[model samples]
Target: MLQNPIGISRLVLASSSPRRRELVASLDLSLPVSVLSPDVDESVLPAWTPDETVRQLSAAKAQAALELLKGRSGAEGDELLALDAVIIAADTVVALDGEVLGKPLDEKDAAAMLMKLQGKRHEVYTGIAVLQSGNGQMHVESKKTIVTMKPFTEEKARKYAATGEPLDKAGAYGIQGLGATLVEEIEGCYFNVVGLPLSLLADMLEPYGIQAI
Candidate 1:
């Protein structure tokens, strides 16, 4: 095992998103990462804005994961309890004209969302929460990236949606995958559109004694 200079014994990711898992692993922190997918209500109030929606959801995921860890018993649980673990949770959304667009309900819904996004500029907001198990200290922040989509025909949008890549992605597109063809340009962090913003996350982890650099 590699020595962790950050003083963190474990890292927990409170999400099942493969993209998130991959991003965290790319940091090469050397600490073992435990994944505990939190089950929580994702519905937001009609009045909540995109940023607020993601922020609250991310915090809820962290809290839910913490509760799960607290509920476990026996050797594994006891070992976790003794370690200084950091739980990382995140939520993402696409906002167009201040309207929040989440994962599509179906192929039709994906195609529709893609059609609406084409030839338009939208904002991708990713809310990240870092929680420390040692002291229960938690910090939450949101990052936004502006993406402009290339103008495409409805037929093209439907074809892309048919690929099924957009079904599980916010705004019905994955900028890092086949959906990259649909994007014209991005003005902010590209990783934010993929899901987690690495630079922002690195800064957030700094206070907890974990440094990516």
Candidate 2:
């Protein structure tokens, strides 16, 4: 069994995002994390609220990772199940009005998203899930952060999109990256806009015997 500096047995992060990993590491938990990107469809359900959409997606990712761990627990005579572990999953989206903005489909789409967001206040929502591998007990929650963007011209939006910085981000911008220049102010947890809300994560982890500090 793998052990971390703090003596936590194992922690799995159900995501492929480097940003999320970095954010987790910043907690200074002194734990080694295994990252697994669960294979799950992220199609938004028409009947779900934007917040619900992200929460459900985050829970689904945790569930998928938990199932995978269970499947591997006894494979090849390995005692994977013997290790005490936990899985963490998160999903984020940008919402303008009632519409959720996901990763852009193309350069044009990214440009359009940025153009629409210019000089507007939008909400960033991130859902987090933490599951204990022992009993499948999990906690899930969603957070919202309001962000105001600088008024920008369509030409600038197109130019920024052409740089490809916004292609993989839900809101066609990353507050921690080149997109910082486009943001006028942030009205909530800054980390939530970045992807993972640290305080929220710490709270969800409490039931699993993990503390951020």
Residue 164 local lDDT, model 1: 97
In order, candidate lDDTs are 0.90, 0.86
Model 2, span 1-213: residue lDDT tens: 122223346789999889999999998776678788889889878888889999999999999998877777777454554257789999999999989999999989999999889999999999998777776777789999999999999999998899898988898998999999999999999999999999998877665557887
Clashing pairs in 1: none
Model 2 off-target regions past 4 Å? Answer: 1-8, 81-83
Error of 2 at 69 (Å): 2.2
Q: 1-213, model 1: which lDDT tens digit per residue? A: 112335677888999899999999999887888899879999999999999999999999999988877666243658555247899999999999999999999999999999999999999999999888656778899999999999999999999999999999999999989999999999999999999999999988877668788
- TM per candidate comes to 0.93, 0.92
For residue 197, model 1's alpha carbon misses the true position, in angstroms, by: 0.2
lDDT of 1: 0.90
